[model samples]
Target chain A: MAVALAALIQDPAAPPARHIAVGAASPIPAAACWLVRKAGANVRLSLLHKRRGNPFTEGTRELFDLAGQGRIDLFFLGGGQIDGQANINLIGTGDWPGSKVRFPGSFGSAFMYMMVPRTILFREEHSPRVFVPRVDIVSAPGISAPGVYRRGTAQALVTGKCVFGFDPARARFRLVSVHPGETAASVRAATGFDYDEPATVEDTPDPSAEQLALLRGAVCDEMLETYPEFCRRVWQREAQERVA
Target chain B: MDLLQLDALASLVLDGATVALPPDNSLPSCALVRALIRAGRKNLHLIGVPVSGYASDLLIGAGCVASIETSGVTLGEAGAAPRFVAALAAGTITVLDATCPAMHTMLQAAEKGVPFMPLRGIIGSDILAHRPDWKVIDNPFAPEIDPIVLLPALRPGFALFHAEMADTHGNVYVGRRRELATIAHASNRVLVTVEQVVDFDLLDDERLAPGTIGGAYVDHVAIAQRGAWPIGLPGCYDFDAAHFAEYARMARTDAGFQAYLQRYVYSDAALAAAE
Candidate 1:
């Protein structure tokens, strides 16, 4: 997942994102950002939760200021419920004020989604409950109406099962590729929203041995400052060695 | 301009006062929060700069907050803030859900003495749809451009937080956490709890001067060692993971939450006496 996200960050179609910001509770995106940086991409990373490598001294206020000023190039966001239109729901399900199921409040998802040019929607959980018909609440809209001064829109949606490329023109998600052991039919069945698919779907390419080596090496170490538990759980051997 | 006792400092915030707490993982004055809970401070309108976690949840569970204005409240890696989740589900407390930058921009408006601050994002979000207080206006600077959302200035009655250190003169060394400085600037009154009270002037030291909030902005200072206990204090310490996880677990039920309060908040005095 980190390798796939890294490829999106390094995609040639998008501008060379000089400044990338990763929000709190995002371990995979943080790893991908670090992996890209370690891969020799000259990018400045602003990790909101990082205690050691976070360059912002003023907390998330600096991140917001930079984003408002059009300084940030790339960002990552996730939602409790995402629909085919790319609308996301982070507030909760059921009614407003009194929700049946409550997720965490929308922190800066809407704000960053509008400001950053390449906002990647990454949610590891891929199921009908997550990919909804229409989100219960739109924390951030996937596409804005005409005349809205949004700098960007959803670039792509990366899930645990497959990757879906978003089309801003039509505001729809297109099946990009499925991960290993997953089929296009499985993705279609799990998803609640409608999307376009090709005649044949390809498996997401595996990261080269070199990329894997880099991810397990310096990238894992960089993740220690903010996401120690994630690193410990994912790269247990490397994390234990660091502790030792 | 010297350190006040915990109770004395806590008394500065009255019932029904709008209090501004620092963001998540920053310097939250847990000691002050305990003191407030002990005093039975009620009907508080908590303004979480952008986000809050334990402090807000503890207050809500104790029936202290009447309304809360913030983006979100969570334990981060630990998990969901149980009490807050319950409150929302019960509709017991009024929630003014805000986006992150909107909170900062509102506070910045107060800090700058402006009536309102206009922002670019949130036009198409459900947050704007829910907040009737927020307005969208045509960009007067460029009529050709789309409308922008304007948020009213957020001027809280009191700003409360914990810091790493403060000098006897009441100047606080917030270090790189400049949002604390902004909180002080925006609030009508500022009360700070510190882990240490140093004898030397913070401004005299070149390293700390730039990040220091002058005593003029600070109304009171209290020395509460590890004031952000359970919650981490940046360079000072790491969060008690076990404690937070326990809180997340125990706060799931009302009876369990009460037990937590009895153990931590009510027994604070006994724990302090033992010390």
Candidate 2:
């Protein structure tokens, strides 16, 4: 998933991601950013959750200020529910303020999704409940009206099952690739929203041997401080330096 | 510095006052939250600088909060904040759902003493729909339709937080977490709790001046060593992850939450830590 996300992050079709900001609690996306950096791309990563050396010195709003000024090139977003039009619902299920089931309220998704030039939507869970026909609420519209001053929209939606390229013009997702063990039919069965797909959909390319080495070694080293549990779970590695 | 006892400082936060609090990483005063709960303060409105954390959940669990205006409230790594979810479910608290930048923009407006501030993005969000005070207007400078959301200024009744240190001159050094400075600047009264009180003026020192909130804005500074304990201060200590994990478990049920309150908040350790 990290490698697939990295490929999307470095996608030539999208705007160049010179500067990327990863939000708190996003381990997979953070890993992908690190993988992109370790692969020798001259990318600057502003990790909001970095405990020791947080990139934002002026406080949390500095990141937003930079994005508003068109400094940040890319960001990653996920939703409790994401619809066909790319509308994400981080606000809960039933009513306003999530009367039924409240996912943690939208952090900065309503702003970041519109301000950043490009965003990659990633949700590890890709069930029918998550990939709904329409989100209960729009935390941020996948596609805004022409005069809404939106900088960009979702470049692609990457789930555990497949990779979907988002076309803002049509405001629809086209299946780009399916992960191993997931066929187009299986993806169709799981998804709630309708999408486009080719005759012969290919499997998502596996991470190269070099990519795996970097992810398990250097990337894990960089991530140990912020994401020890992720490293331990995915790489089966323990933190060398005890943080607490 | 007009240093007061932790309880006395907490007392200044009267019932039904709106208070701004920073999240866990930014230095929330857990000690003060406990003090407020102990005092039985009611109907306190909480404005999470942008987002909320454990402190907000604790207050809600203790029945100290009437409403919360924040982007979201979570325990971060520990997962969902149980009490906050319970209160929301029970319709006990009014939730003014906001995006992070919207809250910051509102606070910035107050800091600048402006009526409102224009912020980009959020024009199409449902969060904008719920916020009746927020207005959308075309950018006057732009020839085309460039609608932007204008947030009303938010000047809270009190800005409360914990810091590493404060000088006798009342200047509190927040280190790099200048969001606390924004809170102090935007709020009506600034009440801070510090781990220690220093003799030297913080603003006089070049290294610290950039991070210090001037004493003129600070109404009271109380010495509460490890005041942000369990949540922890930025450089001073690490958050008690085990404790947090346990709290997340205990707070799932009302009975468990009350047990946690007796063992932690109302315990002797809380008073000793605050003193």
Best by DockQ: 2
Q: What is the TM-score of chain B in candidate 2?
A: 0.98
Q: Mind giving the per-residue lDDT tens digits that candidate 2 earns over B1-275?
A: 69999999999999999999998778899999999999999999999989999999999999999999999899877889899999989989988899999899999999999999999999789988898899998899998878888889999999999999999999999988989999999999999999999988889999999999999999998988878989767778987877988999999999999999998899887666666
Worst 10 residues of 1 chain A by lDDT: A235-244
**lDDT, candidates in the order shown:** 0.87, 0.91
Top candidate, metric TM-score:
2
Candidate 1 residue-wise lDDT, A1-244, digit = tens = 9999999999899877899999978999999999999999899998897764457777569999999899999999989999999998888988774377888889998788989888999999999999999998888999899888899988899999999999999999999999998999999999999999999998888989988888888888788756767877888743335531
Can you write out model 2's per-residue Cα lDDT over A1-244, one digit (the tens) per residue? 9999999999887789999999867999999999999999999999987877888889889999999999999999989999999999988998787878998889999999999989999999989999999888889899888788888999999999999999999989999999999999999999999999999998999989999989888888899877767778898877775333
Cα displacement (angstroms), candidate 2, residue A179, comes to: 0.9
Q: What is the TM-score of chain A in candidate 1?
A: 0.95
Model 2 DockQ (Cα-based): 0.80
Give RMSD to native, each candidate. Answer: 1.8, 1.6
Question: Each predicted complex: what DockQ?
Answer: 0.75, 0.80
Model 2, clash count?
0
Residue-level lDDT for A36 in candidate 1: 93
